[model samples]
Target: MKRIFLAGLLIFALNVNAQVQTPAASPHAELEQVVGLTEVKVDYSRPNMRGREIFGDLVPYGAIWRTGANATTKFMIDKPVMISGKELKPGTYSLYTVPGEDMWEVVFYTDDSNPLITEFEEEKVALRTMVEPMEMPMNMETFTIVIDDVMADSAVLNILWANTVVPVKFNVMTDAEVMKSIDLALAGPSAGDYYNAAVYYLNSGKDIEKAKMWMNKAMDMTEKPGFWQYRQQSLILAKAGDKKAAIEAAKKSLEGAKAYGNADYIKMNTDSLKEWGAM
Candidate 1:
């Protein structure tokens, strides 16, 4: 019984010793960014240079790369976007690239379940584009993917490693989205809807008269309007060339702001009142 107990205790000790934790050779990374109205996400692993040659020798010049180490890189977007002038539907995809001396072929494959890609199927490719590689001034140690040069309707997806940088340009349909929202909101419009639509029109340099009308309607529907609401009403009225009404609205906003102890709104209304020669 004593010998059997000793053997069981030895096995338990060995099992505990074998369960050792170690750092990954290539650490995983995830990045998410909002480009215009679209949500872009990337999941991959970053491998270091480790004093080894990267592009030509280690990764090879004319082979399909997973775009990262370990499992294949996953790319996801919430909205449809035009990638390199080609439309790509919203979905998760495996990102792969074929590296060359001057240009690189970037591909988005529909299949994302596979951790490692052993074969490349042409039919599974959703969108493929050739992007020119730029030589960086300094060397980069770890692989990195970034969404850069963001604008209201477009952004650039950049891949960087070693001394090479590849950029892919994509465009989002912001105007289409805004128009759709406007149409839907007008179908069964609420007070908040009217206010939001008015603000959008005011900021986008649309018809100031229409914005003023909508802002007035929004204020009329509310039993008691806030100081900020009165401030927007004043701006819209001023833009629509109703100086007298703008001054009255600003005065009301100034009174409300004073009661609420809001320093910012008070200053804004006071400034506007002075500009309109009401103060």
Candidate 2:
């Protein structure tokens, strides 16, 4: 009896430790792509055809679909983009679709909480665009979404399932963004920009005259220059073989450094002044 009880206890322990694991019927998939300066992301589940007839049978026509299985399909964009001449702001949205015989309506919804959208809420709809469905020569086993025909300013978002293919074209503001940056750059260099260019030229041994000019402009633009800035100016002047100007700038830097209690700049300026025989 004691042996039988021990055996029973071992069987119970084995049963407790046993676990059954299985693959999901619809597997989750995540896709991310950069369209110019904008980023696009999609998170959804891919359901296989499984030899059953799709479209009009498994997925009924003239009804809104969650666009995927298990969880609501999610679409995210980092920048505003134009789809079918409509603008969509940067955000995460739920993707849905309404299938027809020849056309499909793709939707972007503001609410993305529910796994399945049973009750249709027209108020939460953000954008809806119609796209013509194409028949593919070969069947696609699993549902897939891809960004195809990627260009600098636009891209085609394709949806494939079974033998049907849907393409949606969208445009990004790459040209506008590039033009804005160009305009800002052409406006003029800031004081910090001038200082950085001067320092780079001084360090790179590129045209000491240009470095001297840039450094002077930087100092002129600065209302009350920092000790570090004055130290760099002194170094640039010294490199340009202007000992008198270098000594004058170093003395000003030393005074400012002493006022700011900066030991490193004070030491640097004092050493430069001494090296120039102005100590």
Candidate 3:
């Protein structure tokens, strides 16, 4: 009987060994892409939510959360990111959160010292901001992350989960240094695109003269003074309180728009003139 038991134990051990497996890497992972001329690469991955009710339960309402499963959530930025006008340096940061019923506290932890565990402390934060989550029309079963409406100086960092929509405005400028970068891009290839970007930036309440300077450089390039240049120049003039100049420039821009057969530009020019109380 003893010998039979030994044989059975050996058989069970062999079976268990056969079933054991080793993986090549961690299951938690992300996608990496460089954005902006700064070449800031943002690496992100969707972790296993695993049927967890994100709000008011596992995360708990009115409390801070790391936002997802694993060690404090991480946002790896190769270049610095500006959050709500606050400057953050380029580095790997552990993201923590303060979950609430109406809103959520999004925090950036400076210490990349811990694993994806609830190990972060309040002292480790580099910057933090409370952002209200908007009620999403449709329920989201899985977590989603994306960068929307990217520009030369900013992009909207968006997160959707559990029927909630959260957006964080990420800016590339928080320092005098960013101005230097703008100057550099203005002086580089694709200067026209950079100039056009600057114009949009100013129109949207960003750097005004920076936009003009970029446009000047772009217009100087071999690129034709097409719809983009005309539209931006008109916008700058309008913003400068020159209604007549703006309207005239906008009309000229319409000429360029017609040349390109881009209805969007034509519409934008007409709509903008109206918005500026010009037309």
Candidate 4:
């Protein structure tokens, strides 16, 4: 009985020692956002301050950092984006930055085989830009990165750590996408399609005759055309320098707008008619 008890005690001690857990110093993090139609993703590791001086002592100023604690920080973009007015192609890149008192050098390297950036070859750099660092109001114990101030075509990529914030502005091309969609929509033209094409042509100053043809088709296809469509027709005619037809279309738009009880469109048509000498 004594021998068995001693063996059981030895086994429990060995098990407890083997089960010791030491968590990672830096934890992995991921951020993904959509700016316009482009998808931007970032993968990195976050390291805490742990009550030590971070900037000048641990991270070091004026030196390249992996932008994370462990492994190379991966930045993946689905489509082309403009950063600080410079264009970057769509792909995965390794993000690195050189910390500074005022300005920081941001780098996107195509090759990121080295996590420490110790073998950073200039040839592997895809894009490089400089940005100013902003002082944070409060100390940030853990490193953080976020996509902020998102607009229709632009957003800011922010990095916050140790009371410092660095922001990089990026823009996505929306016009090209809108134009492509317009082309596809106009391929099999419906009444609404014709109206949209006419509006685009009229506004862009491209072929007034085509705009007139499309407006005519839109009106003919709709058994009861809306006042807005007639409004577009009037605008198209006016741009085509057909004052007489523009005035006639404006009158039709005014009548239709009144019938729909749309005060705004009624005012629009009334103003347009007065301008065209049809009131």
Candidate 5:
């Protein structure tokens, strides 16, 4: 039949031009959160050394480079996270990087759900540190992987390729263990991440009237709006003076922190509820 349909259309045009010339598949970078009900997922993979010349010969110093391909570079923690100081439960890890011209060796593979289950099993190490390489001389003709320094609690997990620079530190969960895991994740999930763990126990250093009773029971299981739990229960009801329910919860959290663009948390709740009678 017409030469078997021209040999199956020339083998499907050479398998779609060999998948459009292959190179271009790096993506699965992540950084999830939820420390109370424990749902931290930090899968990461970065493949960029474009202008080449990295580690002796394009990543060949001790060999074992799949660290940024199909798998390896994961860290899906869940509850308890206070590393380098103990308390490290709830797992799923496999993060490795051994690049060294100066310094870089950070492993932590607990191996699960397949990170090649310890590729060659370095005794399945659960922690192997040695970090420090933010060398600046700025050139970086390519290769970039980011996850910036976030801290309301803490975060930082970068690893830019050539010109090197590695950082990995994310310690979150502790305010009596996120208020006993947000009272066990508010009795049992509906999920807004435990209403952000009741607005992170009513904004850190908690205990403002038990964080306004867990921000009014996480605003009755969240419908959302509770902007900073009405600005920390209107500064704990204007620090007990109760300026009429703290100016009505600081005008409902300054209209929801100006509809959430959060201009510096709406000027700190309109300068602490309209400047407290300015005198």
Candidate 6:
């Protein structure tokens, strides 16, 4: 009887293994974007139109859609972000959508296990916002999501499908991070640290004298100063109204870059020297 039972189990396993399977009609897709100090990621499936109606007919109005083909669409943010002027904490969320004639409701659900919008619980919603849908001039064959119009602290999350587009605006806080990094860097001044501070001061229109001081400190700290660092020193000197010193630094930078076989830096120094009447 034990042998018969083992034989039945083997047959069942064999039948399960012999079952036919194929790839999903919609393929999986993933994308990541870095906005300032924040990292945002999205994972979803892309479904093609295939000459069928998407929004109104196949997907019907006023009904919640999975926003993708198979599995729940995932949205992940490493840091807190403000969406539509509202703050959202850092975490992963399931994305869903409710289609309408002129507008759509975008939902960010804390629960990620629900594959169908019908199964999603309203109590698990993290954020729900209504956005106007823009009609596109041409139909998009496959559903697409992109991070667009990126700036230092802001970006647009664009969703395009069929002939419609929806855009969600978000912002990241980078100023606090920049200030914290500057504080840490000032605590322990390395050669690179001094050089970066000098460059930042030069570009941001801070005190030119302070920029020159930091650049000199960077040059003094390094045993073998790089061509790029010397080039930056030259710029700082020029900004400080010391043309003679700038010309001398440019010459040194050009020679160092030639020794390092860095063609780009050599060209950069050469152009600056010519522009400053060093040649």
| Strongest candidate by lDDT | 2
Number of backbone clashes in candidate 4: 0
lDDT of 1 by residue, 50-145 (tens): 888899989888788999988889999999999878999999999999899988999999989854664578899999999999999988999999
Candidate 5 ranges with C-alpha deviation above 4 Å: 1-39, 50-133, 136-156, 166-171, 178-279
Distance from true position, residue 71, model 1, in Å?
0.5
Whole-model Cα lDDT of every candidate shown, in order: 0.91, 0.92, 0.71, 0.88, 0.65, 0.89
lDDT of 6 by residue, 23-109 (tens): 778999999999998999999999999999999988788888878888778999998888877777889998888889989988888
TM-score of each: 0.63, 0.65, 0.52, 0.60, 0.24, 0.60
Alpha-carbon shift of residue 185 in model 2 (angstroms): 2.3
Global CA lDDT computed for model 6: 0.89
TM-score of 3: 0.52
170-241 in candidate 4: lDDT tens per residue? 898877887888997777678888888999999999999999999999899899887788889999999889
What is the alpha-carbon lDDT of model 3 when measured against the actual structure?
0.71
How many collisions per candidate? Answer: 0, 0, 13, 0, 0, 0
Instruction: Using lDDT, rank the candidates from best to worst.
Output: 2, 1, 6, 4, 3, 5
Residues 1-279, candidate 2, lDDT per residue (tens digit)? 999999999999999998988999999999999999999999999999999999999999998898889878899999999999999999999999998998999999999885476556888888999999999999999999999999999999899999999998999999999998999799889899999999999999999999999999999999999888988899999999998998888998999999989998888887888789997
Q: Which ten residues in a row have the lowest lDDT in candidate 1?
A: 113-122
Residue-wise C-alpha lDDT for candidate 3, range 145-249, written one tens digit per residue: 667777877777777777787887777743556678788878666765867587677858977767766765676673567776778778776776667877887
Candidate that beats the other on TM-score, 4 or 6, i.e. the better one: 4
Question: Highest TM-score, which number?
Answer: 2
lDDT at position 11, candidate 4: 96
Question: Model 1 Cα RMSD, Å?
Answer: 14.1
Which stretches in model 4 have alpha-carbon errors above 4 Å? 1-20, 189-279
**lDDT pick, better of 1 and 2:** 2
For every candidate, C-alpha RMSD to the true structure in Å: 14.1, 6.2, 19.9, 16.6, 17.1, 15.1
Worst 10 residues of 2 by lDDT: 112-121
